[model samples]
Target: MSPPYDLVCFDLDGTLVQGTVFIWQTLHDFFGTDGDRRRKAKDDFHAGRISYRQWFEHDLELLGEAGATRDLMLAAIAGVRPTPGGHQTLAVLREAGLGLAIISGSIDLVLHRHYGQVSFEEVLINHLSFDHRGALVGGTPTDFDVDRKGAGLLEIARRQQVDPKRVAFVGDNYNDVSAARAAGLAIAFNPRSEELVETADVVVEGDDLRGILPHLLDE
Candidate 1:
């Protein structure tokens, strides 16, 4: 039988990459950016005082002020690795002829660092830019973050000429709830919030990424 889904989109930080909850928060902690300032920017964004782009730029500015560089940022996440069995899972899914994508608010650097060898049909995440000297210059923030993650999923389905009901999304946190609800098959793997669990079609608790395979693949 054909696979139940044509495409699968994953959230990067906690879902695909282990040992990190949010890449932005991880960078802030690594660079010693002000917590108060970070929180304020975040609050302002959520309160509609600032656009998502503005909040993204503000965070990048904070990191730039702290002398963040591409090399340093890479080093900060050097110890972070893909979730256990994540590589194998992706390989299996690809072999099954399912399209793969990433819809996340995490930085592109993290994705490139860990899953660089892997190929994805689409990647919707923040892209960090650097100057010739490797200093943090600026970044391009994604529209598909937080509450908009569901929209990202739809965009992918549209681009692939597939019905939204043929898409599956796997994620692990509250931010992932929107996409989970949007997908035909939603798997909450190692979920961090009750909201996500409540929204998911399948909830698998474990560090192993392969735990989701049975739910996604036909027996």
Candidate 2:
């Protein structure tokens, strides 16, 4: 059978890595971001008192304060593991001749290194800034803002010369909902929240990433 979609986009964090967000989780492990300040920033962002840009900026600042240097981030990320069958799933998708893309709000260098073995034709993610000495400076502007991920996905399709209706986007969070819905097809992979379940066209639940493969092809 032909591939179900012209292009398929995957979210990098929980969807692929099967762990917490790379930057924050790394911060918690290497450069602690605990306490009231972190909570307030999160709450404010969810409440719209602060924008996603501000939330990320605040988080990066806190991380830098906690001594998050490039080397430290690389060390913290070294231990991260991909979701079960993540590599195999990508292989299968490629074998089936689907264009694959990564659309994420996570740090670019981190994801690039983590998933370096895998191949993605299009990658839309945020970049981290580092000083000459390799200390964390900040983050570069990114198109993967919360709720705007759909726009990024569409942009990928545009660049790939694929129709929007021929795209599939998979994610595991409420932040991924809008993007998934905007795509031609939406798959919620091991959804951790109710909002994600309701937002997706298909839901695949399992410790293994291969579970999504069956849903990607027409019967």
Q: How much lDDT does candidate 1 score?
A: 0.94
Regions of model 1 farther than 4 Å from truth = none
- TM-scores across all candidates? 0.98, 0.90
- What TM-score quantifies how close candidate 2 is to the native fold? 0.90
User: Which digits, one per residue and each the tens of the lDDT, describe model 2 over residues 4-123?
Assistant: 688789988888786565456566667666657888998998899998888888888888888888888878777667888988888888888898899887778667676887779988
Choose the strongest candidate by TM-score: 1
Candidate 1 least-lDDT 10 residues:
73-82
Evaluate model 1: give its TM-score: 0.98
List ranges where model 2 is wrong by over 4 Å.
Answer: none
> Looking at model 2, which ten-residue stretch has the lowest summed lDDT?
18-27
